[model samples]
Target: MIMDIIKQGGRARTTGRPRDACPYPADSRERRAWFEGYDGSAWELSTRVPHPSVALRGVSACPDAATVSNQAAAAT
Candidate 1:
């Protein structure tokens, strides 16, 4: 998966697609052709901190699914 985080109007928006379907591989001639055709800044590879939307809820950071299931069953 290749995620693209774009900065627009003071907020961050993300878009992505599977890497295998892309025509622009890093070392390929197709990548150079793609850049030449676009007017925007060149795409870059980067890592980002987790987005707030992905924050954990009602569970630990690394919860075990089986343990959570058992606990929920006990509560009912």
Candidate 2:
């Protein structure tokens, strides 16, 4: 976990503020990607992509079956 945070350029000193809870996603989605960015004060969702090239970090969980089912149903 520490390694992952470091790889994400988690600079403690620059951050100034103490680290809060890690918002690691508990689910993974196929052909979908989520990103975060800091906007001066705090982190926020940056963007979403249908397919992302980079290997996403802090995503330790796989998407649940029900989520995929619902997405597919909605698409149809």
Candidate 3:
């Protein structure tokens, strides 16, 4: 399986390696960052992508969610 390089700490998932194979020392901020990245990437692997039609409904955010929603609300 091709490994996906994770974003936060620029780490990659090596084939046959456990998801918890973080190089950073445990109980450290770096480890926490890696763990957070693992959490997100793992979740991404499991969840289905948002429907393409969502963007047509203005669910595609620009800048940030709150700002876009506020702008949309104001426009209505």
Candidate 4:
């Protein structure tokens, strides 16, 4: 997996390694940097080619009922 490290007040860095690479060893610079600006909510993962199963699931799921109800109310 390609890892992108973004630190506050610093340029983003990209690190390429095998998907199974160890995240960090104890007492490593990477570990320290990760801890300094780790914001779980700001992180996201995306792919250009999604799996077939995921696409199928998304298509099959129902749309938000509340949104449909709100639109109906507005129309009336």
Q: Find the 10 residues in a row with the least total lDDT in model 1.
A: 1-10
Candidate 1 vs candidate 4: the TM-score winner is 4
- What is the descending lDDT order? 3, 4, 1, 2
Regions of candidate 4 where Cα sits further than 4 Å from its true position: 1-4, 7-22, 39-76
**What are the root-mean-square deviations of the candidates from the true structure over C-alphas?**
10.5, 14.1, 10.0, 10.5
lDDT of each: 0.40, 0.36, 0.52, 0.41
For model 2, how does the per-residue alpha-carbon lDDT over 13-57 read when each residue is reduced to its tens digit? 245434342344444321011112211222223433222213255
Could you give candidate 1's per-residue lDDT for residues 9-42 as a string of tens digits? 1121223433243355677655543432231234
Top candidate when judged by TM-score against the true structure: 3
Per-model TM against the reference = 0.22, 0.18, 0.34, 0.24
Model 2 superposed RMSD (Cα): 14.1
Residue 35, model 3, lDDT: 50
Extract clashing residue pairs from model 1.
none
The TM-score between candidate 2 and the true structure equals 0.18
Off by over 4 Å in 3: 1-16, 41-76
User: lDDT, candidate 2, residue 1?
Assistant: 46
- Residue-wise lDDT of candidate 4 within 1-76, one digit each (tens)? 1134324312212243332343556676555444333322122243123334455676533358767988999999
